[model samples]
Target: MTRLAYSALSSYSRVQIMRLVQDHPGRTITDLCDETGLHANTVREHVQRLIEGGYLVAETERRTTRGRPRVLYSAATGEAAASSPIARRKAEEAARRGDLMRRVLPWTADAELPSDALHQIDALVEDLGDAGFDPIIDEGALTVDLSPCPHASADGSHRDVLCAVHQGLMEGVLTQAGGPLRIAQITTSCDPSTCVVMLRR
Candidate 1:
């Protein structure tokens, strides 16, 4: 993942915008402004940042008889987002960084795992680390434990959107990593202290 992508999530307002787009794809800027009560300029800036970060996709609405179609936004997904040249290049760079960290760090136990699985975990860890999840991997159980999750502060009503977006990001990472491992599920909690992400081969 790129630093830009991680930084995009650092703002709570941006996170809310992301969740809104994820829940309701093809939302126009006006719709986001209406829902978020943010100024139109602020929403436009946030959306532009999200688009640059590869977290959101923008498309023009199609209309038969209209002066102009509105611009719509939606959350980027694993397959579609990773297909972009820039996104693929970033993923490849992240994979290289993950490999470097694995080699230099104290993750000696990772040696026992298959090469592909290790690569997947390396990518996952790097991405999660960038997002400040403080991920702990359970190799035997094929799960990643996230403690003091950055996204845990979201209100209960938006919890589902938070988790789903996170899960989608993980899937995107794995897909970009070109590994055999995948995110099977993410179990979120009412408490912000912990979340579990299950992996499957």
Candidate 2:
């Protein structure tokens, strides 16, 4: 941990909140409150301190519905990855990959492909690769192996939390891409070593 990171995470609540943000970035204040079991006022106070100290940064997301835009907070710690050029490159690649998936999924869903099996599998490979899952697809594309996970170490509560988030991201992409298709679940299983996502047509 950097001096700044250590200094900022000194408090128990701050550390808890920071860890939560690290696992789930772009979380709103209400999301943080629900996840951390912290009151909104208390979360806001701590979030303000984190922002001033450069441990976190806030972003304004455009509202999809008729309401005010929401503010999302993410970790801004200048840790090892933040300082390294290689790490930044990976992050950039991951962002582009994710964006591509977001763009392609809806279109894929709209394409009305004859082989949903093949097309969907192709999309998953591209999507997971761009997200830095380091994906390995078996011969039939029936099984996938994601080694060197996008996450550091999946342990404790985080193991389940991160896996669920990953699953949700993929599922969300599918839902957004395919308007009327209501296949809500993606079969995803993972351990600290690897994550395996099974695709069914």
Give the candidate number with the greatest TM-score: 1
RMSD of each: 3.3, 11.8
Report lDDT per candidate: 0.75, 0.54
- Model 1 per-residue lDDT tens digits across residues 1-201: 236666777777788898887777889989999999999999999988877776777777788896898888877654663243444566677667767776788555465667667767876786687787788899888999997777667787776666767787778667766767888887766676688989988
Candidate 2 pairs with clashing backbones: 106-177
Clashes of each: 0, 1
Instruction: Tell me the deviation in Å of residue 64 in model 2.
Output: 20
lDDT of 1 at 139: 84
Which residue pairs collide, candidate 1?
none
* TM-scores, one per candidate: 0.77, 0.41
Off by over 4 Å in 2: 1-28, 37-119, 139-141, 179-191
lDDT of 2 at 87: 25
